[model samples]
Each structure stands twice: as C-alpha cells, then as structure tokens.
Target: MKLVLTQFKIELLRIFRNPYYVFWSLAMPIVFYFIFTRVISTGATDAVAWNKHYLMSMTSFSVMGSAIMTLGIRLVQERSQGWSTFMRITPLPGAIFFLGKMFGQMIMHLSSIICIFLAGYLISGVTMPVHLWIYCGLWILIASLPFLAVGTLVGCMKRVDTASGVSNALYLVMAILGGMWMPIDILPKLMQAIGKWLPSYRFGNGAWELVQGNPPKWEDILVLAGYFIVFMLISLYTRRRQEAI
Candidate 1:
C-alpha cells in the first residue's frame, strides 16, 4: 500500500512537471469555456442552460484529452525510454505501477472537470442545485472509463511519434463528430447519425441528460462498457506480447 502510494505520488509529480500536460489538462479548457460561453454568446436568454450544457461538453473534451492523448503519449514515451522494462525488472509490483498511472490520470481528469465547472459558474453564470452539480461531475467521471481504456491500448501499441499523431487525430475527430464543438441538432443529419454511434457522443450525451433532469439511457452506458471491455482486451494482448519479447 505504501509503495503504491509512493508510486502514485511520483506519477503525479511527473505529470505536474510537464508543461504540456498542465496547459492542456487545466488551462486550455478554461480558456475555451470563457471564449465560447462568455465572449461569443454573451447576453443569451438561456445563459444558464447553455452554460451547463457547454460545461458538460468541455468537461468531456478535457477528460478525453487527458485520458487518451496525455496518458497515451506519456506511456509511449516511457516505453520508448525503456522505463517500462526497468519497472518490470524492479521489485515494484505490476499492479502498483498500473494503479499509479491510472490514479495520476484520474487526478488530471478531475482537475479538468472542476476547472470547466468553475468557469461555467463564475464566467457563464451557471447555477444548479448542489446535489445536481455533484451528480453531474460523477457522471462525467464514469463516462471517461472507455477513453481511459483506449488510452491504455494506445499506450501499449505505438511508438511515441505514432502515438502522438494517433491521439491527436482521435481527439479532434471524436470531439467534432461527437458534437462537442456544436450541438448535434445543428449538424448535418448524416453527421448526427454518426455522432450517435461514437463513444464520445455517448459520454457527453449522458452528462447532458443528467444536467437536463433526465436519466441517462442504459444504451449509452452499455455501449461505453462494451468499448471499455474491447479496449482493455487489446491493452492486455499488447502487454502480453511485449512481455513475451
């Protein structure tokens, strides 16, 4: 337990030391929240609704960025530097190392969520019951599981450069296609259909539903769980292959 805690602390320290991670996971989303909800859509009648909606969307975006892009690239870099191999040979338990990375990523994920929510409240005048706010945050965190699994899979498969490229591609594509940049109602019919099938869409949709006083559809939860399982299997396979080599 102590070793795992120590490793978790080290992992968090490493993440905080990285300027790119700090900026993307914390600063960038807040900036976007202000730009979109504050500057661009000033004096809107549905300010509260729009603020809450965009808050959820931006939280999803930031969580995806951290879970997939940041975590994936860092894992690839570690593997490329032979750090993964060194860890395998060390007395550190594999579970501890894995937990350390996961916990570190979750910390970043939570930070992003809080920052976006804060921007929504302070800048956009978003107001909600305290319990609703807590529930919405929890839902967003739950929705991040599949993306985190995907990140682990990406981390296990690609070289650093390839991982970076793939992560960026996935991040942008998912964000747009999933309607994070705009509402699905405003998108083309075909695009809306495609977005409905995406994990990102399901994630944001679930959070949006919760914020709008509706229960999240079971279908969305099932789809995310399915994706999570598939990605976990792929990650396990890749790890086994690496171990064999």
Candidate 2:
C-alpha cells in the first residue's frame, strides 16, 4: 500500500515536471479554446452553444494528449534509463506498479479537466447544471483508457525518439479526425465518416451529448472498450516479445 502511494506521488511529480506535459496537455488546449472561441470568431450565431461544445472538445483533446504522449514517452524513457529493469527487481509487484501509474495519470487527467472547465466558465461564461459538469468530467476521464492503452503500445518501441514521433503523429491525427479540433458536422464528408469510427470521436461525442441533455450512445462506450482491449493485448504482446529478446 505504501509502495503504491509512493509510486503514485513520484509519477505525479514526474508528469507535472515534464515540460511537454505542461505545455501540450495543460496549456495548449486552453490556448486553442481561447483562439477558436474568442480570437478567430466565426461569429457563431449561438455563441454560447459553440463555446460549450468546444469546451468539451478541447478538454477531450487535452486529456488525450496527456494519455498518449506523456505516458508513452515516459515509459520509453524508463526503459532506456533502466528504471523499468530496476523496478522489476524491487519488492513492488507488477500489478501495483501499473496501478500506481494509472492512478497518477487519472489525477493528471482530472486536474486538466478541471482547469479547462474553469477556463470555460471564467472566460466564456459557460454554464451548465452541476450534474452535467460532473458527468462530462467523468466521461472524459473514463474515455481516456483506450488512449492510455495506445500510449502503452507506443511505449513498446525500442527508441524514445521513435516513440515520441509516433505518439505525436497519433495524437494529432486522432485529435483532428476525432472532431476534437472542430465539429464533425462541419468537416468534409469523408472525414466525418472516418471520424465517427474513431475512439477519439467516440470519446468526445459522449461529452457533447451530455451537455445537451442527451445520454451518450451505447456504441460510444462499446467501441472505446473494444479499442482498449485490442490496444492492451497488442501492447502486452509487444512487451513480451521485447523481453524475450
């Protein structure tokens, strides 16, 4: 128990201290939100609706980046620095180590969600029922699991440089295709078709629906779960292969 707590604390500190995590995961989303909603005003007819909808989009975007980029790169660096090997020889159980890291990531996700939510309220005067706020936050956090699995898969790469590049590519592609950058309704027909099938789109769709008083579609939950399973299986397989080398 103590070991898990200590490990969680260390992970938290490491995540927050990483400049990449701070800028990309935390700051960048808020900046983008401001730019889209405030600066390059589309003169949205329903400004409040667009503001609220985009809030969910940017929040999902931020959490996804944190899950796929920060966690993935850190795992690669740990392997290179011998941290993973050192931990293997320690008293820490493998499951506990994984749990600690996950809990830490969840904390980071929650913090990012709260910060972006606050920005929405303060800057754009976005408002919603208290229950809606809680639901949206929970939905975003839970929906991030598949991305975390993706990070794990990316972490399996041998080189940190390779992992970083791949993770960035995946992150940006998912964000754009998932409708996190703009509403899928406005995207080209082909992109809309592609985005609907993506986990990122499913992830954001849940929150967008929630804020509008609609329940998230069952397909969103099921698709994300399926992706999570597939990614985790592949990551496990890759890790085992690496270990056999």
Model 1 lDDT per residue over 1-245, tens place = 78988999998999878899768876777788889886786455777788888888888988988999888988898889988889989999889999999998888778778877887888878888888888888888878989999998889855888998988999999999998877777888998999888999999989899899997899889988998999899889888897796
The TM-score of candidate 2 is 0.97
Predicted candidate 2 versus true structure: per-residue lDDT over 101-203, tens digit per residue = 8888999999999999999998789999999999999999999999999989988888999999999998999899999998888899999999999999999
Question: CA shift at 112, candidate 1, in angstroms?
Answer: 1.5
Which portions of model 2 show Cα errors greater than 4 Å? none
Off by over 4 Å in 1: 42-45
By lDDT, who's the top model here?
2
Q: RMSD to native for every prediction?
A: 1.6, 1.1
Each candidate's clash count: 0, 0
lDDT of 1 at 1: 78
Worst 10 residues of 1 by lDDT: 38-47
